[model samples]
Target: MNNLEKWFHSNLGVLRRISQIGALVLVVLIPILNKNEIYILLGNFYSLSIGNLEIADPAIVAQTILLTKKVFLPLLLAGLIPIVITLFLGKVFCSWACPYFLISEMGAKLRSIFKTPQPSLKNPKPQYYWFIFAGVMLFAIISGVPIITYFSFPGLISSNIANLVLCGIVGVELFFIFVILLSEMVFDSRFWCKYFCPVGAVLSLFLSKNTLKIKLNSVACGNCEKLSESPCINACVLNLNPKKENLYPYCNHCFACVDSCQNYGNALTITFQNKEK
Candidate 1:
């Protein structure tokens, strides 16, 4: 009933993207602005601190834990922070903070413009790839490599950005991201994120059946009979049926479904602590 773009523009999901883009910007600025270690609050991808608060990627912790079998309180807390947040907020970090998401979203958009053909998954269970990632990390940890740092997409992008600016050292990790970009452009666009991030998989282990989630009002959803298809499912990057309760760990909490709903039935809403919107 209104300009489609305007309708899309009116949702709260834009705030999510803004925060993600903002974090990406800060990664760039941190290395550029802080030449002297005067600021202790700033940090890179695997770990970050704001004043006394430290947040670390739990996958890094897992790698270290597997290697050392001992938990250092400070680093343990650093890693647990993100995991704990995931437990309460769903995988908000993937949708709202990862730098790789912006690039992948652009690639996905471009692929859509070209009508890029993607093969349907034989096993639609998205977390299968996450397990593959976890297995690799586990093997690497056992092999004494702690290789998640060397191979993680976000870790690489965050590491390289910090290295290139801070130490003037460029590594091969950028090439890895380029290859992933090409993959998204030519094939399954949301493949890596939808199915495979080890760090995301690690964080997902903390998600519970009822932890902050999307709720569907079946009556309102069913009454919207004029639609060509289910917008909630179509809007999902991870190919999830947002109207269902069985959302897997792959959900990034991107809220694209909410944005796509606009003035429609509005049956799908994110619920915090079992409270209805």
Candidate 2:
């Protein structure tokens, strides 16, 4: 195996957790450093400035453009980076760096330990996510308010982190997040990301036939159906079936399934290939 393959084989899960933790740390650290008068990294998830470069959430950028009816070139450019990245890599940000997703995963672990009567892990129709995204955008346009930003859990969490760091008080958004977390812990897992996250919904639109996605080798996946539960499926916090062809829309490219597949015929792989081919 190549060095890259070997590295991933041994470290995919570790690497993903590191990225998730780093994202959380960066969210808090950016505001703290800025409060110390360091201007190197600025802004929250809605809009982030690293040195002279700006990176922003495309969904929010689109909302701003739609609401204000002006291009605002800098904001457009900031949003473009994420769109292009999403086209290439899929909605990896959700799995690798979204603070809310990290928090939800942690909550899921706690739920597992407490052992509540788990609802069926099957996600509702993926169409509901896009419906929420479109509905929020339409509401923002009609109300002349950026209500879409308020609905973005990642942006809200990051912005609230900054608010607490800089202003010494938490925004009400934190309570919104807590309520959702509590609902998921008690009733379902990944309820928001699977059915309601507008940010993820918007990003998923950028995925194309050639975007990176999970591919399953049916031949290599020997007799996993005979097992009570496949290791790869169990490894996925989203409880996704990595072997399924229709996995892209819901799959976050976390590679947890790929890591788990190593001991079980190495059936799952991440690749950039046209789905039609």
Candidate 3:
């Protein structure tokens, strides 16, 4: 009969945020270390090789398959690892590691802090850009080079950060990244992640049935008040409803609701075990 407040009260969200921020800081150093012969922690964006090992984005795998029509061993291994992780962990990379998510989050939080009125309440679906994503990959195949790394905000920012730290070539992607943030600042803050990012959608596609999920205890709690400022609704980074059914594939597993419910209401919980029984 232990409540979620007593069962779990630690701020795992803060730890998760810290780890993502640290990973972003490391991205800048990766190229610098390689250039200076100091150390090679990893490579950039799609191509992340650690020491002697290699790992790449699965999109890169798709691009390779499209372009060369042959599986390259190193790149295959690189791509497979992340795809495998996505199957078990869902779209965790979006929440836990993507540097661009952190940037988007900071913008959203600032908007919330400023009490700025959202331009509209209509949520966007990353699926809206599915055709555009397909077009980009088709371009990669036609050009015989992965152009996704160039347009991907996370990839673009990381590359620019690394290059800027090493030399002074500021990437044009920096301007595009700011345009994205400005749009989020003014309208549809969670729109990109919810409806536009092909990367998040790709990872979401591989989610296993037993992937960890939140469990809202109805026995110990009452229905949410239909309020514009409900704690669970406000706490969601993606602006999703915890009380709503079928929240998976979009939760991002941030556990912010667990924290919010602990402070404001004790009805919500996160558990690996299914709560259906």
Candidate 4:
């Protein structure tokens, strides 16, 4: 195996778990630190300020522009970071740093222990999510309020974390997240990430042909036929067929499929390639 593949094999899910957990820790710790009067990191996922660098969620940025009908230079600059990241890395924030996505993944793991059957809900088309995003933006324009950010699970959960840490109380947002998590466990897995999630939907708009994505080798994948089924597909919580080419706007670049493929034929590898390739 090559060096990259070798590293992926040895590390498996370690790096991702560390990143996800680290993000969760930051969500809570930032508020604690701020409560103690530290200002190095401020704000939550929707909008954050580290040192002098301001980073805002693009979805929220769009809403702000629509609501105010003007663009502030700082807001534009704050929004650029995530857009650049999405251009190069795809919508990795959902998989790597989203607090809600992390909790949802944990629920999926717990269900796996009980040997729960996979949710039979068919995956929605890419346009379905984009339509929701557009509709949300349109509503913000009409209602003169940024409704999308309010419904952003990641932002809401992180804000709630900050609220709990700094203010000593949690809001109704936690209950909303709990309901979503419970529904995911009993019904469809990653239902919100797949279907709704305006943040994910907005981030996906930056996906380009040259962005990072999962690629499959059919010959190596065919070798996986020796087993009952492809482990890559089983590893995908989103129920994506990694052996197929159409992964994106849906893929969070979690690398679960690539890691699972390593045990079989190392068929799936993440690479920067054209989507049509």
Candidate 5:
């Protein structure tokens, strides 16, 4: 591995640990801080809102919209960063900063206890496209329907927590939340991240030739079939075999395969361009 790859592998464990703790704190604290007031706000926002266009946190959107309209400097910088990152780093934000990824990682770790086999990508199908198509149709028909926003885990969690606080009773939503949490604790988190998350669906469209990609060295992987064990495939949480051509679009560039290659000869490197054959 190159210096940059080595550095990322070395530091990623620490980063994941920190992110997990931070996410837990955010989930627990948000409800405590708002108490019942958050529910009141959400209920009002959901009721009067036009055509499923509920703003779970109007304060956040209002602030961002205001900043974009009034303060050009900050909004410009904020907008530029994601565009630059998408062009250069691809979906590093999804792999690194997204809380859902942390939850998935936690699920992967939990799965280790049962020696749960890595999921297989053989005959893998793209399920996210259907959701994307549905979202588009709903938005086109309903005009103001933010259908994609409804299923967003972050938004759902926040709204549900507020609703629970306001109602003074944890209802069916709580049951669903528990099931999600329990499932994550038992299986790989990426199952939901890959199949569901509209944000991930949106980000996949922006990934281009300039984005960072995981490239496999065919020379080192020539005997993959002959080998009794597959280290890289074994390490992949998304069940992708790097030896395969044209990887699935759901890949978040998590670098688990890079960490799994003990021989170093299987040069599955992350780079801006495909490696020279």
Candidate 6:
């Protein structure tokens, strides 16, 4: 890696730290300001707010089917576009757009403060656990129990806060929110994103295809010894060693490495495979 690239990778850790902190603050504060208004904003933009239970959100595909006539356009967009994008571009939404990703990124940062070693990029064994959970949620919705909607944290947090404020019951819900936020300070903030988030699980299924993904050029990499100790790997929030492996399904494509790989001739680039433009 050249001197400039080395410098860029060295500084990327700072940017990742700052962006994560900002995103966490936004996730917590935005819901408090105007939950309904924010819901409308996301809805109009084809992003569903799990908070808006009365309206169909993309998280529950079966619910959307039952309420097809109600939220036709949003439901259609949510159901189809993500699947199609996943066939080629992988889960670009998880990396670039999903609010949950922001929180996960923050969690990764907090893990650093706790001195947790970066997660290995080794192949994550497919568990199919989420598929079973999704099946139960589907059956429950079909049985006329919108139970999943009630317990969704993102939706619950926003809606409960709004209702609490309006009904003057803010103390209890606000207290819960404070506790959740405090937990983030002590443990890994991405805990919610990693294990509990059904939406993320849904996205992961579609992301295992020919999408824009992190790539590593081993020839250019020079095994980190000849270069500056693999800055791209060091900068990755997902703790992936891009030089060693690029196709790890959990990769969010945050482009931190692309920004950090200022040396080694910009070995990583985001582009479509087997396509002539």
Which candidate number would show the highest TM-score if scored against the true structure? 2
The count of backbone overlaps in candidate 5 is 1
lDDT of 4 at 96: 86
For candidate 3, lDDT tens digit of each residue in 118-145?
Answer: 3222333434446656777777878877
Model 5 lDDT per residue over 1-277, tens place: 5887677765654665576566445555555655634532223211212233332232223233443345444433434444456667776656655555666666767767777664464524555455654555455345654544454555455456555655565446546645776776665445666555555555565678768887777777644554325777766666666666546466766767766664556467667785466
Candidate 6 per-residue C-alpha lDDT over 1-277 given as tens digits, one digit per residue, 9 for 90 to 100: 5676556555654654565555444445544555545443233112334454223334566455553426566565657655676667765555554544555566556657777555444523445436555675666666777555543445455445445544546435445535554565566444454445555555666665366666655556555564334667676665555655333455665677777765656677555564433
lDDT of each: 0.74, 0.83, 0.71, 0.81, 0.56, 0.54
Instruction: In model 4, state the lDDT of residue 41.
Output: 96
Better by TM-score, candidate 3 or 1? 1
Q: What's each prediction's TM-score?
A: 0.86, 0.92, 0.83, 0.92, 0.64, 0.60
| lDDT value for model 6 | 0.54
Which ranges of candidate 4 are over 4 A from the true structure?
9-12, 119-123, 226-228, 275-277
**If the candidates were sorted by their lDDT against the true structure, best first, what order would they fall in?**
2, 4, 1, 3, 5, 6
Compared with the true structure, what per-residue lDDT tens digits does model 4 show for residues 1-277?
A: 6887689655757888899999989999999899899999999998999999999998889888879989998999999999999999998899889988888888888877876545332344677677877888888888887798778998999998899888888897778878988898887778888777888888998999889887777666664643336677777867776665456788887888788877677777788876533
TM-score of 4: 0.92
| Candidate 1 lDDT, 151-270, residue by residue in tens | 667767887898888989988778877897898777677778877677777877888766777777666676355332666566776656676544666678787877776567766666
Model 5, TM vs. native = 0.64
RMSD to native, candidate 6: 6.6
lDDT of 2 at 1: 64
* lDDT, candidate 6, at 228: 30
CA lDDT, candidate 1, residue 185: 79
lDDT of candidate 2 over 106-168, digit per residue (tens): 999988888843323343466666677788888889999988788898889998888988988
Q: Give the better candidate number (1 or 4) by lDDT.
A: 4
RMSD (Cα, Å) for all candidates, in order, is 4.3, 2.1, 3.4, 2.3, 7.9, 6.6
True-structure Cα RMSD, model 3: 3.4
